[model samples]
Target chain A: MRAFVLFMCLSVGCLAQRPQPCASPPLLTGSLSVSTQSEKLMAYANYYYDALRRRIRLTEFGSYNNKTFHLDVLLLYREGVMYKMNYKNQTCCKKPLSADFHPLEIPWNASLLGQVVIGSSSGPGQGVLVNTWEGELQMKEGPAKYMSTVTEFGCIPVSTLFHTIRSGWMVTSFFNNVIGLVDPQQLIPPHFCQGAQLEERLDEDPVTFFSLF
Target chain B: MRAFVLFMCLSVGCLAQRPQPCASPPLLTGSLSVSTQSEKLMAYANYYYDALRRRIRLTEFGSYNNKTFHLDVLLLYREGVMYKMNYKNQTCCKKPLSADFHPLEIPWNASLLGQVVIGSSSGPGQGVLVNTWEGELQMKEGPAKYMSTVTEFGCIPVSTLFHTIRSGWMVTSFFNNVIGLVDPQQLIPPHFCQGAQLEERLDEDPVTFFSLF
Candidate 1:
């Protein structure tokens, strides 16, 4: 009886110690196509990254119930600020830096979950979904306790274009076309609004994680 | 300039007021096939619901990194307890009741995001993924916010099967067959182990939400 008991202990112990299968982080840069999908709506976005400069540009287009929504932001780490520019409306809004918004930080070291490559059969290529990267990116700063898949490329290659599922938001992002290098000149806007269209804004209300649908 | 400011306010307000598209709670009873996917693993589980009797049975099979995992649980709200019976290992375990463990208490009223029905080409039927009600269901209990969609069947049928993208865990559940009614006898195990195989245990550590991956 004692020997049988010992065998049971070892069996359970072995099962618990089994190793998980995941690849180390791959080289990732950026992309132009990313989208978010929920039960009712699908929104598409674009991203540009200057890895050496640690800069990011994001533009999101959400059309639901016949109304159009847009968020265009440029994050310049060197300047320590984030700018929300709407090209269509010809307005540029600037917000100061705070703990809540760090657009340049990528959660790559978080445990890897898996890899997914999606393609369209008829189209010549594909586009991954890019996250707008709004709200408290600080939630990612906690210890990495869970395992999830990361893409090799896109706005944040190692990060999902969408937010985490834990936030009561299950938004996901995907992109397809792979552009090799972004020209430095491409990062510059043709013009920054100089007149009254440039609005200086303070920290707007921080979006509660749940408020992001 | 004042006219332009008023127009801007109206534009933003109009965009914000656009109504979300969602149906009311769906009348969903049970499903046969549901699967969960993460970066490293994919787990499939089935559920049997006796809605009238308020009983549920879940059987899950997972194959990860060449290892297989199985969980069989019987939840009888009437008895005010839940049972985990492992037929393969010939062991049965039980856990105490808490507001956190009620799998049948659908968070229908919590919030509604959207609804999805997935089916394969070969199978004509469809199923909604019912979470076995494991892990910290506490994650589902919180103030509801966000506007997505809801199904017509579930408590919030217009809502999502399970929260799609939060908790550092993106658990997607899919069922192919819609089982109308569960016969009561199906809920009973053929036999309970008479003596030694039944191990009396306390609340084993509740699985972290990410561990479900």
Candidate 2:
């Protein structure tokens, strides 16, 4: 059959010529579940990254019904500027490293329900791996159809950083590591964190830190 | 011919069954361009809304080369919380609005350069409508492709609130208004502007005011 239709059109053009996750930017650590309920366990985040020095460090501890919670940040981006240290309230803010602070943008998976299907690069490891196409999300006032699953780790793609109707209250990032490495004093601000001022200075404007969530 | 391939598969399934410009939530004002560079006006933004009381108010002015900038915010949102105040230096923050604060989730068209197509909803006026299918944004480092257009009104969609790669140097809300009406004392915090505290509370784990941009 004409060489099986030219070998299925050259293997669908070499899988549509791959490369589209976000180009290249994943060196991460994980643990997510910003808590929207359902399976329970209100909070618990944990990040650590390098993604070509966009640098990152997060630590969230949880406890809802009983009241325990904590947060620690360190965003440093360097050359392009992005500082935002605040380890346990030492405070320090600055901005410029745009793309909403890339770090692959944000959405870190958003859990695994099913059905988003963005270009579908599919099941792989390390870099250039996209995937979205499965999709559900219909909730106008709840319950109708809500299953989602956004993928990608290297290039970047959690449905372009989240919100497939909040993938049933998030929980992706069970664990990940692009080759690990993060502990240059966790970025900065710790020598007794004494007077660390400078609370805000957003210059490159990324939605004014749009709430850093 | 099989009824013309069943009328071209029911017109490509009615253009893929329309309705995906982000389900509900978009009654936004405008002003975006967080400055990535291109045009002249390095910054500018305007917004005001009620959206059934989800409340919102924004003001952004810019000058760049001569240095003259300003920012005022209000964002309310109730029932799911979202606060944010900040009129100049007044500061007041709180979080919980979830879906990234929902002004259509924040993207706000981004800018016009390449690939971003939503539907083709076309411009006419108010409510439910949506669009985006004009797309093109491939850039990894500098120009290679970047045309985008995202659309919506009654449920918001300036690319979900704005950030198209920062149009050359941004300055996007030339002017806009859902119907005006943002004078609820600009959401309070001006008895003399003297020490308006409360700058971060984000309870819903949206990343803890990552900067509230």
Candidate 3:
């Protein structure tokens, strides 16, 4: 009986060490704020993600390279295409999106940074329980390190920090996330994107490239 | 008939020029991200607002003055007290709060910049409509200019930009706002704040001061 009790204690200890992986809701919408360490660039956007449909959309308004721009970016993973629409010039650039659809989830090989409560957890429905995970993404150029914090329940992304040699450090925070899409048509290309010019050049900036995921 | 039509057109134009003021929901919760133009300081926090009760709470995690800190701040306007709790040291500071309870609303004297849509607005339920308003706050030290963006439907705060001579510029963005309190007890002071030391010194930083609003 004592040996059996010891074995149960050991089982519980092992379970506590390994946290379960979490995946975000298939169809979600949220607001994203991105800022780089240099502070030269800042972006605010509302994003729509449909993992099942392999589509993502971002309506971004921010300053880049000292110039303010309003851009609408749509990534169609199934079609292997991306449309970047510039509101000021009424122009759209269509480019090949070679990145595969990467679902918002903690990777199996990620290192768990433990769990914490955002607010007071003494009472019911008090605090937000979140898990932090860190991992490295192997890109064609180099490996980028990332740390992501997500809600423990829905796996809704809260914030992500990505560091690359080229980009230094960039943080993307997601907030006001809703579990479902408000309009499916938002995932479709905008009216002005009909005659988008095809561009073969790929964006080398890690901040812009990593955003595809 | 021509005179009547002309009068009606002038009245319509006057009404269009005067945009209506908007107030946020009395009780709401959301996440706030703050950053300065200098790139030295950045903060992330979850805020709980009880406007009707004149109470606000913030659980913040960020780096300040090159030091990482986790702070929980609770403001009780009715009691005219503010408590700042440091999670790392388990210390709480209680101070006299002199600021009046200011409801989150567009000021009557604010200039209406314009209305804009965040996403694609060609179809129903495809975009978020928001209004921007700019105004100045009269403070004891000096006047600080501020611009706020809020949703037109529910007056939910989206982002606010405040500029002062001392703080230069700071932007606070709100997201994932949901109406109603998940836990009313969150507004109450935590148990650790029972014997908080009274702090008489007022913070002079405009970024910290304006956050009271």
Candidate 4:
């Protein structure tokens, strides 16, 4: 693929921003307790950035010695229906479910070619079930092309506070503790190396070839 | 799903802690045309929100197309190579190339044994790329469970302002422009909507199921 389009055009000439410090940075996982809680998280003006939280495009499977496991989707609702708190620590009894979203048929006037097509009576189901104003409800799947979204944030036990819990970072209120993993897709392309490996190309004319699987 | 998880646990127990002046805005999209020579962007901040510039990232397919076609996924470069006058309105007649780093593997090393898998003895060829980062680069296949990073901004076109250009809001700007089309296995999930299909079902009696395919 032309080297995946030249490794996606190698990093455009050094770009730099983020670091104003009007105070606001809940989590993005650079750690040192999120650079000292990003200066007390912008003192409530509408901050949010524990690595940009808001994602739950699930379908991940299991693995351990072979590597690949990052579960923590949990949405929680318990007794009525919907439940998907996969658990990271596996304790405190467990109870929070009510997520199915019937398959996102949601299309109110839709625009952009009906959000990419879905005329058929809303039965075949692709996904949709909105209600998130933070009322905890969003299950959107596919539309803007392959889409995936699942929401629920209001659960943090952290094994009752660090027996040893570090991955970038996160502590969230023992005294306002808020290290990493606030979500932002878990700080994309950051955490890796429990068994990381993907760079081998015994060169023929290779300066580098590392992602051609 | 339990009445949408009891209306998202009573709507995050009432606005996930209130606050919303600008907590997580910045996503802006198309039709763009603001550069009337404004530029003040977070200047040591003290309350900000022009709708926080247009706020984006509900998964972002460029916020479902309003800004023509914008998509950025964590574009930040520090000498690792990325320049085309810092990418805006696109115009790199070809010159800068060699700036390599192939380590795209991270499967699971946030701990808790996820197996971790992002290897590439040979993956991504080598050079000839774009997407320097100022927005519009989104593509991270199925699992980046750690989510690494993903960014994208809009309003390009300033090939040297003969036509007179150069606006603001590149999040502070520093060449955050990388339109790199590495095609990270994205067929559209946020609204790209091409072959998109997922209604899923495989039951026989649970509420008279057996539908999704």
Candidate 5:
């Protein structure tokens, strides 16, 4: 009986120390603020994520480079295609997107940093408790380092910092986040995208591509 | 008949040329980006405006000065009181607020700068049509210059620029705005605020007070 109890205690301790991955809700809408050394991009976007369908959509209204732009980007992993719609110019471009769909979650191999409270910890419903995780992503060109802070309760993303060889350093913050989709139709490409011109170049990494504008 | 036609044409032309004030929706939820020479503050807030009741409430979660802060400011013009609550610390301060309520509208004295399209004007549903207005605010300290950009359709605010003797120059941009109130109770002070300590200092101008943190 003593040995069994000792084993049970050890097992419980191991489980407590084990790092667990946090998965964000399948659908969410929010505004993204992306900042880099080269440029600051302020955008209001609705994000639609369908893990089962392996599809993602981002409709963004952004201001940068002294210009305002509206873009609707769709990544259809099943179709292996990416549609980039310029709502302002009424133009659409299509390119091959071969990358797999990555769910919004902490990487399996990411190291767990200490948990922290964003606001006050003195009372319930007063602050947001978040966990910070960091890891190096597996990439074709090279390894890219990333750190993310996500809420403990809902696993909602708060902020992300990414550094890559090509993109340098970038920080993205999420705000005004809602858990469910405001409009599921946002996941579908608009009718204008049917006549998209095919582009020869392969689709670049999402983080890098977004920084272009 | 020709004289009558000419008179009608002139009346129509004059009506078209008259400048009209744009009033924003009473309630909104959006994210704000405030940039100044001294600091850059990024915040997500919900604004509740009651024109008849002469009340306004702003609940903001902001990051600046290398720290994150949560502030809930309630302006009760009818009561002639202002409540500033620090959600992070569970502290509240109340002070006399004698200023009259100002509805979110383009100033009557503002000069019409121009009507411009924010995105592509090539097609319908492609761009946002906005009007730019500039004016000097009537202030006890001095005349403060201000400029505002608002969408012509809904009169939604896009950006505002203000230059005052105390605050210098600051630019504020709004994004992800929803037209109606998400939660009406946000206009009411939290339970903790009932025990607020009365502050002696008069409330500073909102534009200048926000820049402090």
Candidate 6:
């Protein structure tokens, strides 16, 4: 019994098999109630990044359709390791890289009835999504469909050259609102450009150069 | 001087703009900031869009180095229409489209740069785009490029049917993120669907969908 308890406790701290975020500093927790103005104020994001082990008996999956969602949350470390408990179905999927940012494409999966992948967002670190089952939906094309959009959401800055590689999330665009561009390399410098004066030039004249950097 | 003032006033309200926003509702104005998770929370945003129009100037565009940032705030609007104002330039770029709902490809004239546009975007109405220079952008690749990047952004939601189209400013993704695959048609319903049932559905299901009514 002692051994079993010890094992369980250690597992809770950090799954030996994955890369997950532990109790780091500056934690944010809350619930999103309003559909307008201030929905992002709620912290503590929820995701079944693993897609296989994450399962729930209830159908509500991170949606705000009036249901009071209750679930333990897990944030994947930069290494892209999610446990089996994040998805409804339990089929393991792995990627050398994660679909973490947006304007990204999520490979097709059998479990996700209808899927959309918004990744590598240019917003703050609040780049998340709200989805629902297809059984409850309606598809319509309207006058807005004929239009185009643009924005400068959370464009990556040129500052942290020796830290992490995560890009902050910017303003997300709904069907109506569009955001601008933000580069993540601003926080964590790519492996190639280490000692160069990238931030200074960027600050002097804020322009993103894909080729040079 | 009096005669000149009257002529200027008449042109000010009717400066070759599309119909004013009748469907757009009052929106909340907020600062554009990014959250950083260190010993403290760091929020940094720039008014470059304003600088493009010669509105206000910042000390720098980005950091004066080669490091890349993950998240920083960009200018955006959600009251349906976005406002692009160059107070110094005395030009405004107005668009009467929903940031979360509308998706029109307002034909761009490169000269539309630094101009501000504002109008109602709750549902759909005529929208416009203007540039500062010759009023036309260079066509780098496809007709779409010369047109505007809004088309590619539109493809995200438009590709998926029956998806939710938000009504306010949203966080967007540039390269990769995870919330990219939401079928706007699936989550969104008709603009006409409202009232008790709508509220009930939104409240009970942890899921969100759009109405085509």
User: Best candidate, DockQ-wise?
Assistant: 6
Residue B16 displacement (Å), model 2? 32
- For model 3 chain B, the run of ten residues with the poorest summed lDDT: B118-127
In candidate 6 chain B, what residue range of length 10 has the lowest lDDT sum? B204-213
lDDT tens digits, residues B31-66, model 2? 343443332345556555555666666666666566
lDDT of 6 by residue, B1-213 (tens): 999999998888686453221111111111222222221223233212121121211111222133433321112223323233333444444333222322222323332323211110211221112111122222223121111211122211111111122222212112222222222232222233222121112222110011110
Could you give candidate 3's per-residue lDDT for residues B97-159 as a string of tens digits?
A: 877778888888889987654432332332345678998988677998998877766777777
What is the C-alpha lDDT profile of model 4 across B37-130, one tens digit per residue?
A: 1222211111111122221111112221233333322211222211112124332211222222222211222222111111110112110111
Candidate of highest TM-score? 3
| Interface RMSD of the candidates, in order | 14.8, 18.4, 10.9, 17.8, 15.7, 13.1
CA lDDT of each prediction against the hidden true structure: 0.40, 0.41, 0.75, 0.20, 0.67, 0.23
- At residue B147, candidate 5 shows an lDDT of 81
Q: Which scores higher on TM-score, 4 or 6?
A: 6
RMSD of each: 16.7, 25.0, 8.8, 27.6, 12.7, 26.0
Residue A64 in model 3: lDDT: 87
CAPRI-wise, candidate 6 is: incorrect
CA-based DockQ, model 4: 0.02
- Preferred candidate (TM-score higher): 1 or 6: 1
Q: Which digits, one per residue and each the tens of the lDDT, describe model 5 over residues A1-213?
A: 999999999999997665477777776655565655334555656667676676778777777775787777888878888888887687778887767667778877889875654322332322345677988876667988888877766777767878777766566766556666667777787888887776777535554232221
lDDT by residue (tens digit), candidate 3, A80-132: 88888776777778888877788887888889976654432332332345677
Global CA lDDT computed for model 4: 0.20
Off by over 4 Å in 3: A1-19, A37-39, A85-93, A109-127, A134-145, A163-169, A188-199, A202-213, B1-213
Better of 1 and 5 by lDDT: 5
Tell me the interface RMSD of model 4, in angstroms. Answer: 17.8
The list of candidate 1 runs beyond 4 A from truth reads: A1-42, A63-68, A98-109, A112-148, A151-166, A177-186, A192-200, A205-213, B1-213
For candidate 2 chain A, the 10 contiguous residues with the lowest summed lDDT are A119-128
Residues A18-77 of candidate 4 have per-residue lDDT tens digits of 111011222322111111111111110111123133212222333334454433222211
lDDT for model 3 comes to: 0.75
- For residues B135-201, what per-residue lDDT tens digits would candidate 5 score against the true structure? 8876667888888877766776667877777756666755556566557677777888897776776
